[model samples]
Every structure is written in structure tokens, then in C-alpha cells.
Target: MRFFKLFFVLLLYGLSLLVLPPVSSSEVVWSISARVGDNVTLPCEAPGVVDFEDVAVKWTRPDLGPDQFVVFYRDGRPDPDNQHPSYQDRVDLVHSQLMGGDLSVVLKNVTINDSGRFECQLIQKMENQKKWSESKPISTIVLKVSDPDPIEARVGDNVTLPCNTSDVVNFEDPTVKWTRPDLGLGQYIYLYRDGRPDPENQHPSYEDRVDLVHSQLMGGDLSVVLKNVTINDSGTFECHLIQTMMFGKRRKRSRSESELLSTIVLKVSDPGSTGNRTETGDEGGHEDRQRHGLTGSVCVVTVLSVGLFLSKKAKLSKSF
Candidate 1:
């Protein structure tokens, strides 16, 4: 009888261990960098999760104060009551189905103000009860955002407005658009898609005036060269990179995400004009100094030669 009781207790203990939820022991922190208007994903996962219905995930920025979460997901859906206002409509789970324990969240159109440390926590729902277990942090992500600088060019000069996705490995075959917002809506300065430049929607003013290095597309360089830029070209140029992703159980459905990778302000001015005086004046001043220095050296050499010749003649005459 004593032996049977001991065996029963051991069996119960083993079953309990098998039914208990898994806990993440990792405390690793990840760092990610992005530019303004870029979409970035912060990764988090809970292993051994057989059912997502009983799991709740919360992503919080501690600096935002207590109860202010970047994302609060419960009851198999997002709970927006406690989410921060700034993060509203700008955040979403990478996978709505929570496939393979992936609880990563995507932040879209991020700005510099979004730079901060984010924490992800997992809360386990109690069996046959309305209560939940204490939240356990499983991941930490630090995000940094920055803006691109403006580009300057002179009239009639060929200019390259830079845009690239080379930093992202595996990114391929994305549709690229360069648009000048000041040129009215739906009008683009350049457009490339379907492995070639589609000029059908390009602005008439930019016809035959812009070109992209198609050979470098695979390398992620989407820079466009503007030939003989005019003062009218001076405006904000935005580079949009649109990528299509297929997701779902069968991977049959498709969705597209557009990233505004670069916002460059082009300042085109005539040569030697006041609008470009600062740059042109600096170059002109440098050349003037160089010319003056060369002339001064030549004059010194000529003077010294004349004095030496005169001295030599005087010595010869005296000796004669």
C-alpha cells in the first residue's frame, strides 16, 4: 500500500510539470536603427505556447509612465484602453494569428520622438479562473530614429538624389517612386516598377530629364539623376519604397507596405547667383587666392633675376 501511494504521487507531479506553461529565461536586449517615416519591427517570442487564446502580451515603454503601453493585447485581441495615444493607429502585431509564438510588433512611420526602450511581457491566463498570472518580461528592444539631410545642386548640373535599401539584406524587387510633393498630388518625378522604369505616370516636366541606374537596383541603390536641374526643381522630393508580402496559412493573400525611406530637399540655383553665392563664392575665393599666390611667386623670381643680372654686369664693368 505504501509503495502504491508513493508511485501515484510521483505520477501526479510529472503531469503537473507537463501541463505548466513555459517561461522564457532569456534577458537579452536588442538594438535597432531606423529613419523617420520608416517601419520597424521589434521581435518577441514565447516558446512552447501550444494555444495563444490563453496568452496575453503587453509591450510597454517604461519612460511613458505606468499603465501606458505601446501595445496591450489580451483575450486574443488588442486592448487599446491602456495604449498610449501617440502609438494609436501606428502599431500592430506582425502576425495577427500569433503563429509560432511570434509576438513581434511593427511600428510604422516612426519619428525621432519614438526613440526609446521597449519591453515585452507575457501574461498567462489562469485555468478555470478569471485571473491572470503576473506578467513576465521576455524581451527588450531599443529603437533609434533619425532624419536625412537636404541635397543642394546648381542649375544645369546633373544631380543624384540618393536613396538606398542596401542596409536591409534580403529586401528585393520593391517598387520605387520619387515624387515632388510641391508639384501637386499624384504627380511623380520618377517611377520604377516591374523590373523597369514606367514613365506612363511620370510628370511631363521631368520627361527625358531623369534617369535611374537600373543595374544597381539589386544592390538597393535607387538614386535618381536629374539632368540640367532648373530652379523650379527646388522642392521636397520623397522616395517611397513599396514591398509586397504574402501572408496567411496558405500564403495566398498579399499585402503591400510602403516605406518613405528618404525625404530630400533639393535646392537648385543658377551659377554665380545670389541663391548659390555662399558655395560659389567660397570656390571663387579659393581660386583667387591660388592665382594671387602664383603671381606673387613669379614676380619675386623675376625681381631676383633682374637684381642678379644687374649685380653681375656691375662686377664685370668694375673688373674691366
Candidate 2:
């Protein structure tokens, strides 16, 4: 009976090992950030890969849905049929031949909506076997795409909408455009091209009211100063960096391919009303502090009175 019981225990343990899946080695999750319209790469690599053609690599965003891969490469080419629509024509392997086991991919023209967690997986098929092994994760990356914070100003006060591209060195003589999307297309607040301000394409309302700091242009500072801001000037502003591309000895400007460096929200308020609100907030805070002090004083007095009464009662009882 004892022998049979020991055999049963061993059988259960052996079965459990087969039923449970093997634990995979952990990979570090990397965090990366990029501005809108910038090209960013997600790093991934599979070590000990000699023949890249025998293996397949897949980059996917699991949160998007099942099978919604960002880039799927198998059989020596990327299979875009199962890829997500948003990533179509925008993603590709860093190396077409998968050099040095590197499975990284370049994501071009990123937008704010592309911020999410991405995963890189590797699939390998066994020799002389038609079935492929389960996909194993090689890397995990969290991408954050964003713009600068909004700017606030009072009416009649000058405000600077900030935009910079110092990190991007692709363009030497890029055109800077600051425009309000609410003002419609072709109606820009300021346009800088060919080392000078192009006021001919600027809106009539912004005439002589907007200026750029030419001294700081070389540092990639495309900041614009809006003088004497009005309440009606409150809106969303976009800064576009247009790169000049060379085509057979001729330089052509591609406005459509411009990168949106920064988006700033300018809020202009009335100075008189702002001052009144500040005063009101200060008065309210002062009143609250006074009430708190009074309450604390009352609490101290009550505590002292109880202690004094207790002391006197004890002395009277002792004398009796």
C-alpha cells in the first residue's frame, strides 16, 4: 500500500510538469518619447540567430487587438495583410536582411495617437517540421508621443508661443510656420522662409503684430511673439518645420511633408477680470486661515480649562 501511494504521488508530479507551461526569461521594458511627426525606432534583438531567413519577427501592439501587428515579417518579406491599418506604409524593419539579429523597426511620422506599448516577438520553425513554435517576446517598449504645454497670457500682454527642433538636424534651412488651425488654411500668423519673414502670406489681423527672433533661428528656436494679444486670439497654434529637399540640383519645398514640431494652446484673458479674480481668491484664502486659527485657539483654551478644573478638584478632595 505504501509503495502504491508513493507511485501515485510521483505520477501526479510528472503530469503537472507536462501540463504547466515553461517560464520564459524576463525582458526589460523600455520607455521612449518622441515629438509629433518625428521618426522613432523601437529597439529589439534576438541573439544567436545565424540564418535570419529561417526565423520570423513580429512587432505588435497587444492593446490594439489580437493579430493587429505593427509589422509582420515572414518568408523573407513583410506580410501587411494582417498589419494594422494605421501602421501601413509607415513601419519597416531597420535592416531588410536582419543584420546582426537586429529586429528593430523604424516608425515614421509618428502622431500623438501612436503612444502605446509595443512588443517584439520571434517565431522559429523546427527542422523538417511544418508546425512553428509559439511566438516568444524579445522586447517590450512603451512609446510616448506628445507636444509642449499650453501658454497663458492676459489681454494686451505679449506672449511667446514656443517651438524648437534643436534635436532634429535633418534640415539646415527649414521654413517655420506658425498658424492657427481655427483661422483656416493659408491664413497663417507668421511665416519664415529663406531667412526672412514672408508677410505676404500672413493673415491681415496679424500684420505688424507678430515677430520672430532671427538671432535664435540657428538654434532651432521657432518661437513667435504675439504682441498685444486679444481675447479673440485664443486658439490652438501649430508650428510646422518645412524641410527643403534637393531634386537634381534644384531645391523644392514640400509643404505637405512638413513636420509638426509643436502645438501650443494660447489662452488670452481680460486683464481687469483676471486681477479681480486674483484679489477674490486671496481674500477667500485669508478668511479660511483666520477661521482655522480661531478654531485652534478655542481648542487650546478648552484643554487648559479641563486641566485646571481637574487640578482644583484633586486639591479640594485631598483637603477634605
Candidate 3:
């Protein structure tokens, strides 16, 4: 039978390459968490590979000190000659998908020491043999160093809540508290020493309402300015970080607390009115002011115009 059908198609193509199943390569799948100008996305998942679109991509940092290449490429041609000037221009390598090898990466304006640990590399060259496709073991993104975003005023509207902790340079002076829980009292607006603004221990309804307080206990600009906001101000605010933990030295001094809230929801207008309607409050304030008063929107529009002209004169005297 034609030599048993050509040896049964070469033993079914070598038993389908020994039952196939083998394509596990491509790391640094995805990992991201940021805050500092905010703009990040790094995901690289290569598999089985096929025409690596002229491979050659590198982004390193091997964990701070040493191996901080940052950027590099050759095949796809993008090797700023061995890039490293602190990642000139901030770093970028997302060449339109590069034939699906996807070496995604994008960073900019983030400051908090730029947080660390990042590596996405791939180098594959044919024609002779030059292979290397790595991905996992290294792919970490953390830029938690924060301070910014907390400002919304109304009442008397005179805000300057600039609690922008400029990427902390470590001088220690970030424990500013402010809360107006239903007007019960919870002050102490500013206390940043060594750089100014330490009004004794301030908190007499904001003593002077704080202003232009330039604080930088090393780099955290804990700004403050709340000129006039009424309606009993508002609540819920936090600006984290207060550390002091050094095990193995009999020492511990930690304190990470960041809270901010200067809300003022108060806009008043009416009060006391038999039933002509007008009672705004869920914060639009209105009730109070009943100092022996009763609203009279023009006597409720002349008693609904004399009860609609006596019901049209009793319906024309019952239609005559």
C-alpha cells in the first residue's frame, strides 16, 4: 500500500513533535501602583515567540544601586548608545506593539524617588544563535510617596489648603491635623518648625486662619490656608506617613498620620412660612432665623388670590 502510506506520514510527523506542549517564556507580565504626577503602565507577556520583530529591549534597575541601565535596544534599533543619564527624557519603549512582543512602558514627572525595581528585557537574534528572553522574577512598581489633592471650598470661600508634601526629603515636620467634626472642635492646623509657621500651638478657631505657611522639614511642603469657610466646616481627611521602626537597635519612632478636611457646606436663605413652601437645609441651610418671625411671601400671594375668586363665584351661582 505504497509502503504503508509512506510510513504512515513519517509516524504522524514524529508523533506530532512528541505531543507538542512547550511555550513558557516571557516575563514581567504586569504590575503597577503609582501616585506622583500619575501616569504608569508596564506589562510584558511574551509567549512561544515567532519573529520577535527584531528583538532587543531592556529596562533595568536591578533594585536600586547597580544594574540601573534603565533603557536600551538594538534590533528594533533604539539604543541611545547604552542609555543611562538618569533615563534621559524619563524613559519610554512602547514601539507600537513591536509585532506583539509588547514591551510596554511609560513614565513621566513622577517623584517620590520614583519608587524602584523594574526590569523588562528581551534579546533574540537568529542567523547564528543569540538568545535570551526573560520576564518574571523582576517587575515591581511602587511610587507611594504622596501629598497633593485636597481642596474644595464653599461657605465663606477663602481656601489655601496646599498640603502638597513635595516628595519628602526627610526633614521631619509632617504631622499637621485639621478637623471640624460638626463644630465640636478638633484643631491644630499648623506646626511645622525649623522652617517657619509654629504659632505657639495654634488652634483657636485657626487663630489667624493660617496663611502663606511655607513648611519644608526637608522636602514635604505641608501648605495651609483657610481664610473663611463657615456652615460648621466639614470632615474626613488624612495625609499619611509617620515612620520610626528600626528593629535591632532598641529604637522605635513611628508616626504616619495624614488627615485633612476643611469642608464648609452652608448657604442660607429662608425660614418661618405657614405653608408657602421654602425650607432648604441638607446643608443649603435655611431653618434658623425664627427670631419671632414668619415668612410672608406677600401674604402667600394674597391667599391664593382670594381662594380663586371665591371658586369663580360659586361656579356662576350653580349655572344660574
Best TM-score among the predictions, by candidate number: 2
Selected candidate, larger TM-score, 1 vs 2: 2
Query: Would you estimate the TM-scores of all the predictions?
Result: 0.52, 0.58, 0.30
lDDT string, candidate 2, 1-320, tens digits: 99999999999999999998765685657899997657899999885635766788888887877767899888889998788988887888999889888889999768888999999988877887585666658799999998645578888998888777765645456678888878866789898877678888688989999888654486778888889999999888888877676666666555544556667778888978968999999999999999999999999999999999999999999999
True-structure lDDT of candidate 2: 0.81
lDDT measured at residue 114 in model 2 versus the true structure, 0 to 100: 90
lDDT of 2 at 25: 84
What lDDT does model 1 reach? 0.81
TM-score of 2: 0.58
Model 1, TM vs. native:
0.52
> Predictions ranked by TM-score, top down?
2, 1, 3
Ranked candidates, highest lDDT first: 2, 1, 3
Task: Select the stronger candidate by lDDT from 2 and 3.
Answer: 2
Candidate 2: give the clashing pairs.
Answer: none
CA deviation > 4 Å runs, candidate 1: 1-24, 149-320
Tens digits of lDDT, candidate 1, 1-320:
99999999999999988998665577558999987767899998875545777878888987997768899888778999978988887788999878888889999778778998998887778886598776667889999888645578888999888877744633445578899767767788988766677898789989999888654475788788889999998887888777656677785735454556677778887787775778888999999999999999999999999999999999999999
Model 3: residues with Cα > 4 Å off, grouped in runs: 2-8, 11-22, 25-36, 39-88, 91-121, 125-150, 155-212, 215-218, 222-320
> Going through the candidates in order, what is the number of backbone clashes in each?
0, 0, 17
